[model samples]
Target: MLVAAAVCPSPPLLVPEVAAGAAPELDRARAACFDAVAVLAAARPDRLLLVGTAPEAESGDYPAGSAGSFRGFGVALDVRLGGGEPGPRELPPSLTVGAWLLERTHWQAAPPTARALPDTLPPGDCLAAGRELAAGDERLALLVLGDGSACRSAKAPGAWDERAEPFDAAVAGALGTADGPALAALDPVLARQLHVAGRAGWQLLAGAAEGADLAGRLLYDEAPYGVGYLAATWS
Candidate 1:
């Protein structure tokens, strides 16, 4: 059963070494992520499910010990999912950030499991995956890593798109309220066009929390470097 959840952005800049000179820009987002993770720890779940985007065309399960590095982002920092020994898979940036947050929180109570779903996965399939995770008898918590839209300003990664603001606002609202149906209703085509990578994972969250009575709190919402980054906690 679902117990608690934390929504966070997956930017490599979340790591100080990767962010370099721009490290302080995301200080608040980082703090909010820590606060959200703290909520998960307080919940004392049986296990934690780290859900985020993967480069694969289909969803894949990763061992708790999966390791990944930020060398591609000009940083040699490496992170492991949990205390377990290194596994075969190399997590993508999303899960890597999740691992970093877990490490910062020193997560220990619940064993952690990682699941990476393709960014362009269909909404139905995303929901199905979420449902299966929620079906488990153990109390499961989720650490979801994803970014809203990258087109908030003229200098944004995707360039300024008039549609980006509304799209991001909707996403923040959905996450802040734990409105599963609203998240499920997010338009995939529009999201893709706006360069929003959080759609699939957020939809999966909707599936996982389908019938649960979770209370939500919007911890942070901002567009640092023109990427809409949000953090929220549901308990």
Candidate 2:
């Protein structure tokens, strides 16, 4: 069953080395992520499933020690998913950010398992995958990573879009309350047009937490750098 979850944004800039001078701007979001992880640790789950968006069409499982690097972002810094020996496959940017969070928190409770789903995955499929993940007998926690709309402002990566604000607001509401149906109801076409990369991952989260009695707390929500970066915890 799902015991806890931490929702975070997937941006290479979360790494201090990658952000450099602009690193300070994301300090609050980083701190909130740490706090969310701390809550998950407190739950003492048996496993931690790291969920994120990927370029693939379906979920991709990454071993506990999979490695990820920020070299593509002009940084050579490397991160391993857990303390275990490194695996053969390296993580994508989304999972790389998830790995960085686990490393930052020095995750020591439950072992982490990585999984990523395609951005265009249907919500029903995401929910099904989530239900299957939650079916395991062992207590499970999740570290979900993906960014909201990238076009919150004219300076946004995807440029300004009138629909961005309302879309992000709804997402924030769903996450803040752990409202499964709301997340599951997100409009794929609108999300795509708005550049919301986190839709699939968040829908998966809704599926995993279905019927779970966890309460939610919104830790952080902002459109820093023109990307919607939200942090929340459910436990």
Candidate 3:
């Protein structure tokens, strides 16, 4: 089976050093960041594609537009199996599938240097690009890293905060489609765990380690951020 993985790292909106006298827990935050990474890798997907914003230092180097601000922070990985493709009707693994799709499918603003990287495409343009890249490559699976903005925008009809209801709708829509099963690594506090079950649909798998309240608060209070992974299918 084809598998993919995506990792989204959520650093506090403001840098720890910048928050004057605010006793922010850098160690805890960093641990959380790495934990997200670990979770994505564990899913063991076949194909992985990474997406996200420029690193903190890189973000500082470029002017707002020059750097892809819209893109959140994360990573993706794609894996191929047996040097062949899976049947069109086969289903991919669960785990971080939805999160991976959300991240890779969306584009973010980034600095010039980072933009030069192969994966630095705009989220708005990625679906077409991804379709092209996957053309004639049916065996390939996709993993994406998203910050929850683009997905929200895709679903929102009017002027809604990209971070609000629309984001939820997009997840629901993807679940409804035949893309693959999706699982969201959501904070229970932020939202309920969404499970998209269908042939190629996706599910939302919340991270048990991150406790629902804290995760929920993080999603609601802070911008949405998290890592995702796609699991490898066993033939």
The TM-score measured for candidate 3 stands at 0.31
- Candidate 1 TM-score to native: 0.97
Measured against the true structure, the TM-scores of the candidates, in listed sequence, are: 0.97, 0.97, 0.31
How well is each residue in 1-235 modelled by candidate 1, as lDDT tens digits?
A: 8899999999989998988888998899999999999999999999899889877753588887889889888877888988778877788889889999999888877878788888889999888888888996789899999999999999999999999999999988988999999999988899989888788889888999988889999999999888999999999
Candidate 3: tens digits of C-alpha lDDT, residues 122-154? 332333343443345333333323333222333
Which pairs of residues collide in model 1? none
Error of 2 at 120 (Å): 1.0
Alpha-carbon runs more than 4 Å astray in model 2: 57-59
Question: Which one wins by TM-score: 2 or 3?
Answer: 2
* lDDT, each prediction: 0.89, 0.90, 0.27
lDDT of 2 at 165: 86
Task: Highest lDDT: give the candidate number.
Answer: 2
Q: Model 1: how far is 51 from its true place, Å?
A: 0.8
lDDT by residue (83-202, candidate 2, tens digit) is 778877789889999889888888888878899888989999999999988986779999999889999889998999989988998999989998889999999999999889899989
